[model samples]
Target chain A: MSTKSTQIRLAARPVGEPQDSDFEFVTTELPALGDGQVLLRTVYLSLDPYMRGRMSAAKSYAKPVEVGDVMVGATVCEVVESRSPKRGVGDLVLAYTGWQTYAVAEAHHTRRLDPGAAPISTALGVLGMPGFTAYAGLLEIGRPQPGETVVVAAASGPVGSAVGQIAKVKGARAVGIAGGAEKCRALLEEFGFDAAVDHRSATFRDDLEAATPDGVDVYFENVGGPVSAAVVRRLNKFARVPVCGLVANYNATEAPPGPDRLPGFLGAILTLSLTVRGFIQDEFVPTRHDDFLREMAGWLRDGSVRYREDIVEGLEQTPDAFRGLLVGRNFGKLLVRVGEDLTRE
Target chain B: MSTKSTQIRLAARPVGEPQDSDFEFVTTELPALGDGQVLLRTVYLSLDPYMRGRMSAAKSYAKPVEVGDVMVGATVCEVVESRSPKRGVGDLVLAYTGWQTYAVAEAHHTRRLDPGAAPISTALGVLGMPGFTAYAGLLEIGRPQPGETVVVAAASGPVGSAVGQIAKVKGARAVGIAGGAEKCRALLEEFGFDAAVDHRSATFRDDLEAATPDGVDVYFENVGGPVSAAVVRRLNKFARVPVCGLVANYNATEAPPGPDRLPGFLGAILTLSLTVRGFIQDEFVPTRHDDFLREMAGWLRDGSVRYREDIVEGLEQTPDAFRGLLVGRNFGKLLVRVGEDLTRE
Candidate 1:
């Protein structure tokens, strides 16, 4: 049989909004699988805001993806052929195979997914890195106490959505901040938030103030811009800010123009005794990953935690979809449907 | 016998720098001590940076010093007349007697100080609250691992000086940042810091970079402004920042003008995965104070820790000395010598 695969590669780093030229799509022949390795066909590709950081050459907790390399991403795939004792002809698995149609990886690198447990796509969204990020960061660092208000920006995204829901489960009030009225409505209804404030509203500040009467105890910061500034003003003494991302300024090339509010922010921290912690999900994997898998699975099963996916068809649409993820264009957990799901009922 | 006592009271909230009219010095007669109380004559009054927060009507971790009230402060005092069996006449003790020369306090409110254990004035400086602040904040939150770099600003101040020394004791590289060459020199010679960078230098940023080659793992932030901004750039991955004070902008009335840099600061937090925790020393007193006292006493006994004092003379000069403390005029722990120590050897 003919061995062929389609792949997406980074063409150039985008300045602000990514353009079509920033990615190159190529169709090439797949290499033959070796001993103890499996040939997998991509089914679903996760497009996340973090991919923007990997595209830029800026120094970060993780190394940036080199130009011309396959854009790094997490994918749910179907094992087409296996050369090892772990026989998997049609078994679905999770892999970090980047933006490619097919990849040859060691069988041990892929974790087999039980199709009966949950949707294979759920492994890339709710039951994966983004969900676990919310679990570990909020529980371990944020520590939202009962009756306290927990505020999260980008509240419709996977990480923020899970954060708001988990805070509710912990007996805390969840106040979600999203871009528009629709997302805000989704946050309140779909995500089960106590209050949802539209950051895009002209009266957003007042809305946030009205939403959090007792003031915010834990602010799960993912979007740092005017939204974060407004939220910071309403924080109570000894508030905990677990910074997970800064999607608002991901494409920033220079420092924002300023009356220089750094001094004021620092002063607030000193006066209010705030705790601002920044973390990546991987840091908590060794300690809390197992707990996350069990708890998140249980939450999904019980309908306590809900997740939404905004799927874009085909691997060719991955680059444009990723750009939309950074600018808050695509709602929910942005994903690209790479290939047909043969196991779907 | 008739007793005349002079006291400083807050007359009005100062707009920027405090003026003479902002304080009212009154000579009052002291009443006789009650059954369980002692008449105290203030010897050394601690004039700290936190007093600035108290003077303002702005909300803080602590309540503001109301207008027409005696400005609060910590003091080392002598018991002139004791009606209680717990305290003897001529006993030296640490008290929260504000800016008054003489006052009556319950016996249990004061802790007796032995002149044999360092000095009576040490109760208000290196061996007291400021010292404990450095100890607990650095050890508990800062958590500097062995061989890692620990950077601290206000290198000559009691809290910062102790921070550098304690970090060194824990086998970490201590880098002190001070305003002038004299204080910087003292940081290395007296406090035993690995390196002391003069923040006033034209090439301060370069100096900081050269001093902390491995990047700062722990930054005990006491002075916030350009010094802190410089330190933030050198922070390593997962750096811990225990924000103790922001003396630089204590008098700020409004948010400074900006192409706002707060977003950028948050961006760095996300990329570096840093932990910035702000705290007041009182919060940790119940849990860690006893351990601090034991370990600090041992450090002082073995000469592993050293401290400096910038003592201003007399109770009448408190208002002017307090103004100096906020502007970093006082070199070490700013203390006002309120009364004569006639018992000193």
Candidate 2:
């Protein structure tokens, strides 16, 4: 049988901040599932800062979604019809179903998710890509040692919160920087971050300095802008910076006027003996993904780690929710609940 | 017996380009050598760009030259008198004696150099700190894979020359960047670099692009101004930037006018997944120095690596020779002939 899938397709390439004009809602008919294919209904659609990159034509680690294409994202879906033995109907699965409510994916392409183990939605957040990004980037690149200080921005979000928590797990002090007192409080109170500094505070620089007495040894870079610049200035000698995302500048139209400080930036890198490495999450999958799964799941189970899901009601809320993500409006792991999960409800 | 030692002391810290008035020359009396102590006559005094850092009071890996302190440097000296079993009268040695005609040091503090094995001046150039800077930083941090492209600036100088030649030894394509046609010629003819781009040339950017068609895999960053800016722009994904020095900005009094490109720089580090590491060569001593000595000696013997020296006639000419090094005036490894080597003649 077939199903109707409602998707948010790329309407136009964004100039700066993505607008309603940049996306178009479309309902398409899915053809009958072929052999070795599974018809899936997306229970939870992931909304991440990385989605902004897919919206633009800019060159990045991954290819941008072309105009007239479905906006891509990780989805926690329910298998509705299976044409292969690899998956069964009513089984929860993880799939790349983009911004759609339903998809026809090959059986091998979808991983079966056990509903008994935590929640299926986590495959898009803490137990999945975002968590793995924090894990692999922080440990492999940052390599924060005992008694060292790790600083991460966007601290209330999945990646930054995970980075802070992981640094603490490694015996390093975690300093979290967020946009407001509310988020900063959540960083320390909810995520158990060692310290939280409000990036929007009038005395943000002073607060950052006060938060990290020993200086930042590892800076898990998620938000890149003035916040990153201030943090980088306070980096200790031999500091490690793992550049995971630049959500701050995702909407920038052009480079700001400059005396061009790339030289001074390089000068600081030289004098301080800094290690600045940029990476995406997938690079460490072969070796680190399993460890991330086992560890993060344990941390969640034992109450050592906590997660918050900010779920918008429907597929239509995806764009606005994503726009909120770039501006630090989302409080935690942002997700769009496109349809009811039959496994739970 | 007592002897008179002529030394150059820092009269004051430099503001930008070091002035003659910033230095004071003095002839002081030295007492008779004690047990295990040696009185040495300076042979070759190494003049390097890192000295610019020492002339400033800024924080660095090593301490700065204090006002009224003898200007610190690496020196090749002849032992005029020794009161130890480790060395006898007339033995050549390497010592941190600074810019001076003579010094009194403990015999164990100096490493005796065999004049019969190689020219004693080599201990200050290709076989010393600069060469080791190239060796350790390039191998340990840069780690250029075979068939990859390795680019280094200051092409004819000790560090950059060794970096290019060693890159060739490791089966990578070595591209050299220098200031003038003469240095550019030496990069190809003397150092056997695959391509040489003159930084002073108007077509430098285009030339660099042509030279590095596969994109820069490793950039041995020594100079950090426009040359570095151009090189960094062409770096491939996962490029290794072992930032050994920033000779171009060593004398800058303030941050240049900015569109403040640090954010964009961080963005590139994120998008390209570049590995930018800064280091001082001394950190790798215990782990890699022995390997450097053995391997570099073999390469020099087989002519797989070649070196050149620009020797100034007298100690009084040291200041001019040093000033020349910062502006790419000297053709090769710069040295000052502080006192004649009787063994060589």
Candidate 3:
């Protein structure tokens, strides 16, 4: 077993966009596993937009990962050794091992990955938490009927991509909004979205207006900024807004300047009888997890749902890769290849 | 039969708080009534906060009352004479008669009011649409569970008072927020609220915090301003907000200055899994109106629910009375006694 492990610890609570100095990489010795524990080496670390929330001490659905803690994350790992009766050495498993090369955890804390079904790395991306979030939030809350328009921003990310495709499967018109034309084009060509609007265009508002002529019925809101503002304008009566994440304003240092528009927004809510609900996907897990696994596994098997991953090399590159996530730099599900995958079939 | 009748017509759209010049009160000769039409005399006119929405040309759930037209309103009137066999002379009925002393309406357009069941004027207050608004919005959307704390503002008014009491009937703790000590006292002593907080007091924020220690499960939102800001801070996870009106901002000529807090508000919505829905009572009328009528009528008969009315004398005082309603001057459901109720049994 490897004695030394490389880990990234949070140095400070970021005020807005996180900086490199906010993290400290350290080499630490891994302690021996207990009777029920296993030694695991991380092969892939998932960098998600939600990590931005955990970096800040702001009130949220989950507690912010404390400063100086190995920045918390999900990882796909190869089990090095096991003391538990349930596990064996060389097993590939999924774990919440944070930004680290290796760690020791209880055997029950990790789920063994079946590489025959798909690539082991997929346990950290497309068939993982982000994908599940989109599926549950859209189906349970958005509840788009056939022929209704489903609008989603951050369209190229794991969650948004899954949301758009799921809406299509439900027979709803999927409208994807992304930062540039490339991602927008990918939304239509790769993800099978009915319409894709480039939010970076100077005429983005007009483009959105032209694209969704029937108005938005279910807005799977992940990016809340100018894109959300434009979407709000196009919302039809009785529109449903599932507030999953607000990546656009996650780095905000202070409240934006205003002739406060909340009253106007509330006026729209009243006049249109709109339903604006905010949710974290974990709330729906207990009720819908089984249904999700069965349906998503079926969808994947049939090629009804497709996904992409943007993999970065090495644990040392995670900080830079994560910084790109907030500013829309990465093209797909951003993951850092922490270690070599030696168990691939 | 009298040929002359006085009518109040919308002269021009008011920019903010309505002015006397914006309403033109003119005496006009009544047109001859055709078959199936009845000549009605307005007895009690309902002056509600929603009338303000009609005065504006902005798009809303309902069409805007056009300028130069008689200002739309709900009225309890006496059928003075009838050309239709369905409505008899001297019958009391609820009609959409607008702000006029007398008007001719189709006999089928009005529902006969039973003076014996309750006072005829109660048709415009507790036994009518405003009361039903409180019932449907609270039970259907707010859905306060037993032992949960339900909070409502404008607690001295018809809608808010009913919400608080109905919440109590459902085994929830009812916290009533009113503008002054007297209204607050009425909420506790007269309406049987579990707790009453005076929003006018300098210690209102702390008082509200103390009153709702377990956090608010349902907020029956009628008056939205500082009161809403205070109540929002006390919302529990999965808190349901049934937004019925925003009386506090009704007269605002400009958006209030702010370090815009909308992002923060949306953040709270995400973190708390809050459900904020805006609805006009009429929307639910088709589905839940019968249920509301059965439940509210039973509650009133058993003394489980009570109501208050603030009656202003004569049609001439309506403009000032309405201006008062905008600023929370009237203590309860504000109504105008247009004429004597001679047909009362």
Candidate number with greatest DockQ: 3
Provide the clashing-pair count of each candidate structure: 12, 6, 0
lDDT of each: 0.90, 0.90, 0.90
* Comparison by TM-score, 2 against 3, better one: 3
True contacts kept of each: 0.86, 0.86, 0.80
TM-score per candidate: 0.96, 0.97, 0.98
Tell me each candidate's RMSD, in Å, in order: 1.9, 1.6, 1.3
- DockQ of candidate 2 against the true complex: 0.75
lDDT of 1 by residue, A1-345 (tens): 556888888889878877889888888888888899999899999988888889888888788888888889999999899897785788899999999999888899889998889888989988998999999999999999999999999999999999999999999999999989899999988999999999889999999999999999999998888899999999999999999888888878777877887887887888788999999999999999999999999999899999999999998888778878887898898889899987675
True lDDT of residue A66, candidate 1? 83
Native-to-model Cα distance after best TM-score fit, residue B14 in candidate 1, in Å: 2.3
lDDT per residue, candidate 2, A95-191, as tens digits? 9989999999998998889889978888888899999999999999999999999999998899988899988889999999999889988888899
